[model samples]
Target: MAIFTMMNSLAALLLFLISSSSLIAASDSPFILAHKKATLNRLKSGAEKLSVSIDIYNQGSATAYDVSLNDDGWSSDIFSIISGNTSTSWERLDAGALLSHSFELESNVKTVFYSSPAVITFRVPTKAALQEAYSTPLLPLEILSDKPRESTLDLAKRALAKYGSLISVISIVVLFVYLVATPSKSGAAKGSKKKR
Candidate 1:
């Protein structure tokens, strides 16, 4: 009789744990957000750099979900992870040592955008995962701004314009340093004469 009672107690505990886990997953499944998009057409010279600006608040709600970019014929010229204002509050992913980086989400009334950023292929642990985790549908995300407009020339021009001054300054400084550090022919000859 004691053995049977023990078995019954164990089964009840297991059922309770499963039910609670499912309830939690359900709550977080359906999360969503709204984001805005703009394009600077002149800078995308054979490169894809997309900037995302979340201008509005509570535009979309979803449980924790993932993002994915269309990956057909795709390559990342420069893959980067950047932070906006909510760096201290968001949970980060563990990609491994040497590859570990933060993937924090933007918060209310804050904006985060990537500069000459590579297009993302996707974000993992999808909506289904959220459902499984919390037994709720993934949160819904509403894109607030117009969808990203495609203009290769505009992207290239924009990129050049934004980074142009920095590039020119670096070039000038490098040239000046080279001229100062390299000995001219006359200087070398004068040094030999002085030695004699």
Candidate 2:
């Protein structure tokens, strides 16, 4: 009888522990994601510039509070901000919400610029410490270049890839014209007979 009682006690303790763990895990939390992209553009006056864009997404079970982003990783001596601010913050980002920020930068240093990833931070309801995330990293870019890096052959290949359907359509039209304008063998024979 005592062993049975002990078994029942153990079973009750196990059930209590399981219920508590599930209750702890049922709380909602927030998740923040940031995507960054940078593009290089050349001006007609032979000036080179850079454009940076960042997209923030909240894909969590709860809303995030105090969401902030900072993209000021570049050195001031190398690149100057043309427009827009480098840092921004929001009061809250609900679950599945999206935000976007952009800024333009210009440099005349004439060197290869290695970019850095943007940083994002936000607060979650279930945690005390602020959560941080890094954006997508970009590739190195050449600034203030005199000419494009692609050769004429590469440009031709790109053009062909872009207009391949037009070339095929022209070929089909030429074949159709040839088929309609040329006389058949039987027609040629009948014409010769008529002439004779």
Number of the top candidate by TM-score?
Answer: 2
Give me candidate 1's TM-score against the actual structure.
0.25
Model-by-model lDDT, in order?
0.38, 0.86
By lDDT, the best candidate is 2
Candidate 1 lDDT over 103-196, as tens digits, reads: 3232221123232222222123543332211111222232122357869999989999999999999999999999999989998999999999
Candidate 2: misplaced stretches above 4 Å?
1-27, 149-152, 159-196
C-alpha TM-scores of all predictions: 0.25, 0.65
State each model's C-alpha RMSD to the native: 22.5, 15.8
Clashing pairs in 2: none
